[model samples]
Target: MEDDMLTCNSVESPGPPFLDNAASSVATSLRRCANDKLPVSDNRDTTVSRWRKHCPTPIENDNIFEIETHCKDPELCSTLACDIYKHLREAEAKKRPSPDFLETTQKDIDTSMRAVLIDWLVEVSISRKKVTEEYRLVPETLYLTVSYIDRYLSSKEINRDKLQLLGIACLLIAAKYEEICPPQVEELCYITDNTYIKDEVLRMEASILGCLMFEMTAPTEKCFLRRFLHAAQLCHEGPALHLEFLASYITELSLLEYSLLCHVPSLIAASSIFLANFILKPTKNPWNTTLSYHTQYKPSTLRDCVKVLHRLFRVGLGSNLPAIREKYSQHKYKFVAKKYCRPSIPADFFQDASS
Candidate 1:
């Protein structure tokens, strides 16, 4: 009986001098490790095997949160009910690019150059409809492609001559990551008008992967928007497609402005939802407890970001980025670009919305 008691104590103890604290604290940590739902595994081998199969290998300095289940009901799962928000918060905190990711101040490139490159890439992605025979690139792929470009550009210094090559390489990487059957490398070369050989594209891909340290899972605005949109739906049971389209336009516009890079994806997402709600339902409050609890942003907190997004939207009305405009101008997108992109927002709308 004594030997059994000793074994049980050894199992219950958290195994380290620092963790050797009150039983309550140790129990809390163990609960957290099990996502606060189940008791810790008593069988050490079973615990190890379970983690090996289900949990991702921990990275140094990563605040890893164990998600209990995949969120099928976006409202309950994404909000305070499940571990999704905790996981998202930890992932965003862990994966955010450094503030000085861009070395353009010392290099030949500048923000204007980056914007132009991104604009051209947007055109290329849209033009894929005419170039590719079978596959049409999805919006997620475009977002990811741009993300890869920005992260890679922030890390590596390159001449303007190779900028298009870099864009193509990033697109290939994104397609592979997001698409089921990505376009061929030779096709990607052809889309660039053959300015870059297949070998050069392959080499640039290697260089980008090396610079990024194989970290391609950076959170994009779309990831957060999905959850926020679901929360918005819980309150507004009306047709959500309009708000979704407008929010997407807002997000895409954000992608063009280099200054916005300083903001995290979650902030951009929350602000977009707030803006969309303000425009669609002028009388209703754009935010509430559910949104705040899930997105970690109150209405006042989203004010500055919403203002910035509003400025970008207004400016984009007159800007020369025709690809985005034309893409949204299509009937399938409900002409959201033409309908919503404008210079004048009523001053009283902001005043009323905030209150």
Candidate 2:
């Protein structure tokens, strides 16, 4: 396979990997300032004075080990964790699509056509999954790949013939961004049964990067889902594997619907967890103080989006895109999809819990 595939060495570097460092620095400085051990000077006109007012402590130590040790304190680490989530939420907000993003829907493409393409892409992604037993591609990469396709399609019009080409291009971009070793251009072409050539894939890759302004770090539903899952786990006492698998099912189902793209990724994540909890244990409340604080979504705020997700889930029962269902139905995924039930949702399920 390595001998037959063309590598993507030409893809531009993803640029400085400083996000972790930046977050750590912020956390450390804030921690020191809160302790008030930082030195203050009477020279208010100096840069150091201004820095003292804000950062307070001078970062005299460049020792990575020392900084790591300081950050390990749970009380201080909580502050760091809060800062991380704050930064992530802000980034997600900035990357969120405009309310009219879907208005750019191509005249030639309708819901049915889009669904067919997504169904096919889902299979291709699964095939990629099977190629390597070890180091399997992360599920987040697939979500990102589909997100890139939708964002690109929503922004530009293309003939139905080029849809597959666009799909592979988006996959390539996402793989490069998310995976350590992305599939070669040749492998992607082969996956499509040679419907597209390597050069065509390359050209489309360049075009997609251009259209997306090379902004491939957009916040994806999977990112938020992981965070929310962690938060939910802290509150729930039951076996969480079933809840997790069902929430993942709901998340992937949302990816198939074009209308759902308008909602932010975090909302989709929160709603998925909410819906999954409802399915797993209908009598109990899903949202708690811990989940609400982390996800920033009360049960009431998630009501409308949860309703949309439930409708999509119900519709998927008879829909042609069974790739997600089939994938989850397998043993390794705990066969959550096979166990899915369409139980009667309470009429007030979507109502505000507090009311």
Top-TM-score candidate index: 2
RMSD of each: 12.3, 16.7
Clashing pairs in 1: none
Please give each candidate's TM-score. Answer: 0.72, 0.74
TM-score of 2: 0.74
Q: What would the per-residue lDDT of candidate 1 be over residues 1-355, giving only the tens digit for each residue?
A: 9999888888887575354458759788887888757666677446434544532332322222222233355445322433444566577766665545555422776767667777777776665643346457777787788888877776677888888888889989988998888889998887777898999999999999998889887678888887777767666656778878888878887887777777888899999988877767666667666566556676666767788887876667346666676777788777777664335444544342235
229: Cα error in model 2, Å? 0.7
Lowest lDDT block of 10, candidate 1:
59-68
Provide the global lDDT of candidate 1 against the true structure: 0.71
